[model samples]
Target: MSFVTDHILKNPPVLLGLIAMIGLIVQRKTFAEVVKGSLTAVFGMVALTAGVNMLTGTIAPINTAVQTQLGVQVADGLSDVTFTAEYGGTVGLAMFLD
Candidate 1:
């Protein structure tokens, strides 16, 4: 069961395909529609993931150059802020409230 859940349910492409299949089934779609929908969903996720990977690859060199030039200076008013206090209140409050 863990293997099935880990390999199938938790995989992005498989998860998207499963969701599409389930959605089509719930709507009583035809067999062709079910298969096409699931495959499209899976491929769509794969394409999106590829696009993001390309974007990050392109950005890496720019990020490195920027950091090299900027020399890791802190933001103007945030120089003394501890990491815990920096985002803790905003993220914590939003997490529970939202």
Candidate 2:
């Protein structure tokens, strides 16, 4: 599932699936009192996500300000650091496991 659509969307289906499971929990808590409660749980998640998106919008500016005001610089985002090495051995993971 991830291999096919990991790059397609920012939130990804995994997040939605998790939200749905939690939404179910919320519905169960009230014994599924009404359909509106379940729907509200889902909508609440959407609203929460929107709020987080707004908060994240300021991260860049906040980072810049902190870096500029203070002498401390912060490293953010992904990094391209990898090491490749070839080994010649029995490759011991755990002899008992094998």
Candidate 3:
């Protein structure tokens, strides 16, 4: 049908891939090797993912303890603090301290 042809033309990659897969199947391409290779890659990625999770898990507790004991949140060196100034008075970090 014209509609099917138009749809295929609009999505060339999908159309080409579908045709290639059909051809491979007609030519008797066994998917056994492909499945094995994919499984191996997935296993390697799973190991790396687990290691990253463990690394973060160890650091999280230390960060929480520092914030709780200090009563201030540490984020990129900008602690949660506020300041007020009297005009024409002492200035700089010294004034903020006193």
Prediction 2 TM-score vs. true:
0.39
Which candidate would rank higher by TM-score, 1 or 3?
1
The all-Cα superposition gives candidate 2 an RMSD in Å to the true structure of 11.6
Q: Which lDDT value does model 3 have at 51?
A: 82
How well is each residue in 7-61 modelled by candidate 1, as lDDT tens digits?
Answer: 5644667766876898899899999999999999999989998998899789968
Candidate lDDT values, in order: 0.70, 0.46, 0.49
Residue-level lDDT tens digits of model 3 in 1-98: 44544454333333434444555566676786444444555565567657877887898799899889989876563421122122112222232234
The candidate scoring highest on TM-score is 1
Model 3 spans with C-alpha error above 4 angstroms? 1-30, 74-98
Query: If scored against the real structure, what TM-score would every candidate get?
Result: 0.67, 0.39, 0.38
> Lowest summed-lDDT stretch of 10 residues in model 3?
80-89
Model 3 scores a C-alpha lDDT of 0.49
Candidate structures ordered by TM-score, highest first: 1, 2, 3
Tens digits of per-residue lDDT, candidate 2, 7-71, equal: 32223233344445556665665545444454665577678767877887768688788889998
